[model samples]
Target: MSRYQQASHVFWRCQYHIVWTPKYRFRILKDNVGKEVWRCIQVYSAQLGCEVVELNVQIDHVHLVIKVPPKISISKLMGALKGKIALKLFSKFPHLRKNKMWGNRFWQRGYFVDSVGINEDIIRRYVRHQEKMERQEQAELALD
Candidate 1:
């Protein structure tokens, strides 16, 4: 076999930065709830064969930097993550089942995704900063 043929079979590292918010942007993930939500995200990501490189659960949204196999479609991966987390969260915390949280859906229809190319460090820092940003926003809102 040619060297070129052997090189073609190599797998490239793929990193995906994803961000999504709750339906209607509800601030349901407060205090300890955020930890639970993060746990659910971790569990779901593991089930989907994705490595959770960085993750932050804010009051209204979440930021996740994951490394997924090339075989998975972005939509399918997102759906699986959202679905599994939603089921686990709602089942664990019945209050989240209220219409305010989401009657039938856990996440909003749209999500932000970016390929972390050479800026993986920047994206990781951004994901980690999500919680701090959320806290600052809450503090600002409280001052009003």
Candidate 2:
């Protein structure tokens, strides 16, 4: 199980599974470019107080599993991640900008996001039990 981080009052374990692809699903991320992207991800994630659980930079798409603090919203995080990575890549690999599709885009506008942690069944069972206990307590009081 993943460990939780605590704030002054809130305890959170927010992890997300994210996947995105380059514009048009081009296989631009390979070899040195892919390696650089990986490095930037690690560096930027730490800067944003996120723990990168797993990262896979494939030829056409990238996959990431990360734990982010509650303070950072998912949209904000994704914007920063994609924006910064694109800037860094265009800077290091100037040739990429030559292509029309790559002229102003790196990753596609949207990405896949899903919450990852704990089982839904566990939460359902916990809630049901609590409701049952509450109902039983109320019934006993009514009979008294």
Candidate 3:
């Protein structure tokens, strides 16, 4: 294969982090629509030339770690993923409109992104800690 073809054929890995919450941090994402929202994110990410490495859907927000090719711009990729997902989600879940998931918009505005390196330990810890933190929050809430 030519160099260009070889490069294109080779998988490029990147980690994309995204976070968005319901207006006023409402826990509307605990229902069936929550799963749908996550599926939408996965579909949109694939369309943007990325593979999801990990995803965490909290009660209020979401976190995603994805792998993407070098050819795609972060901004364009995020735009496509968030935009398409939001459009589809709001369309399918009409209640989202009432909640104002977006203040006249879908997603907040921007998301967090991180480049993963060879630090497997760090990545694992972060992913694990995400869940732990969620559990802790739930526990604390239960006490209240």
Candidate 4:
């Protein structure tokens, strides 16, 4: 079951796959930390009239499939999302600051985002595969 969004004069299904990681590739996102990051993304995305179709929060990176409106620029949306998450995470978990030895930053300087259209299902499958791969990698590392 898929739904499309509508504005005053336009009907659209503008979706994107966005991925980003923490600075220095730290593995600090776990337990309560991961939960807070998810919450922040959900709250911020909703504020922009966007819906999170799928989201995956890994220890070092986060991925999301978001349904956005055509009115907003992708860069603007990402900036707001990243900025809000960084501010909230820093405030909610002060210990996170210690990991930022180089500078007071949460996320890396850049992100990966792709527009999703007819290949939406393909993108979802890719995200799911990412989770599986990460789990397998962790299990293998644990055995080492």
lDDT (CA) per prediction: 0.81, 0.83, 0.70, 0.87
What is the TM-score of candidate 1?
0.82
Looking at candidate 4, what is the lDDT of residue 86? 86
In every candidate, how many clashes are there? 0, 0, 0, 0
Kindly give the stretch of ten consecutive residues in candidate 2 with the minimal lDDT sum: 120-129
Candidate 4, residues 56-76: lDDT per residue as tens digits?
Answer: 898889989998889888899
Better of 1 and 3 by lDDT: 1
Candidate 2 per-residue C-alpha lDDT over 1-144 given as tens digits, one digit per residue, 9 for 90 to 100: 548888888899898878899999998889999999889999999999999877777777777888899999989998999999999999999999999867688999999987876653443343335435566898999999
What ranking emerges by lDDT with the best candidate at the front?
4, 2, 1, 3
Deviation from truth (RMSD, Å), model 2: 15.4
- What is the lDDT, from 0 to 100, of the residue 94 in candidate 3? 82
| Candidate 3 Cα lDDT to native | 0.70
TM-score of each: 0.82, 0.79, 0.76, 0.88
Clashes of 3: 0
Top model by TM-score, which number?
Answer: 4
Clashing pairs in 4: none
lDDT of 1 by residue, 1-66 (tens): 431111246655678899998889888777766788798888877887778999888788888998
Inter-residue clash pairs, candidate 2? none
**Which residue runs of candidate 2 sit more than 4 Å off their true CA positions?**
119-144
Error of 1 at 27 (Å): 0.2
Question: On lDDT, who's better, 1 or 4?
Answer: 4
